[model samples]
Target: MTLHGRAADAREASHLAIPVGSPILAGAHRWSDDEGVIEYGEWCLPPRMTIGYEYQP
Candidate 1:
């Protein structure tokens, strides 16, 4: 077991990748071509989102 220890265990199993998330939507989505609909929408959090997949260990 040597080739630089199997390339350092394949770069530590492809580098310690973790901690990443996104889902606080709604930052832009305004439309009003002469008042046709939706205007000034914004959300910092709370829209309901939960499917699954949040850890690699």
Candidate 2:
């Protein structure tokens, strides 16, 4: 999924996606501090549950 506009909104959406298909809890983060800066954000899959993405840009 591609999200536009505020990055915070996009980060929120990524968190909501982790539970699809009943995946095991891995780890996630949205590294935004009080400085109002977002450096990185990502989520992980269980060792047995791997996923791939196709990027065309």
Candidate 3:
């Protein structure tokens, strides 16, 4: 696959992995590179508010 194609595939995979109805905390994490970037944040379930990874892929 080409570089852009690979990036898009990764982005799609990350979107698919997240559970529905989770609340995401903005700016929880960040990443950058010469070609592309991705950010990871935190999300939580209600009541317990268990933290989980939120991906911006």
TM-score of each: 0.24, 0.26, 0.21
Query: Please, what's the RMSD in Å of model 3?
Result: 12.6
* Tens digit of per-residue lDDT, candidate 2, span 1-57: 222222223344366553334434344445567897476554444324556679899
Model 3: lowest-lDDT 10 consecutive positions = 1-10
Q: Which stretches of candidate 3 lie over 4 Å from their true place?
A: 1-27, 43-57
Best-matching candidate per lDDT: 2
Per-prediction CA RMSD (Å): 18.4, 11.9, 12.6
Model 2 weakest 10-residue run by lDDT: 1-10
Across 1-57, the per-residue lDDT of candidate 3 in tens digits comes to: 011111223333356454443333222344667866665454222222244467897
Computed on alpha carbons, the lDDT of every model, listed in order, comes to 0.34, 0.44, 0.37
Q: Show pairs that collide, candidate 3.
A: none
**1 or 3: which has the higher lDDT?**
3
Q: State which candidate, 1 or 3, has the greater TM-score.
A: 1
Q: Which model scores highest in TM-score?
A: 2
- Candidate 1 wrongly placed segments (more than 4 Å): 1-23, 34-38, 46-57
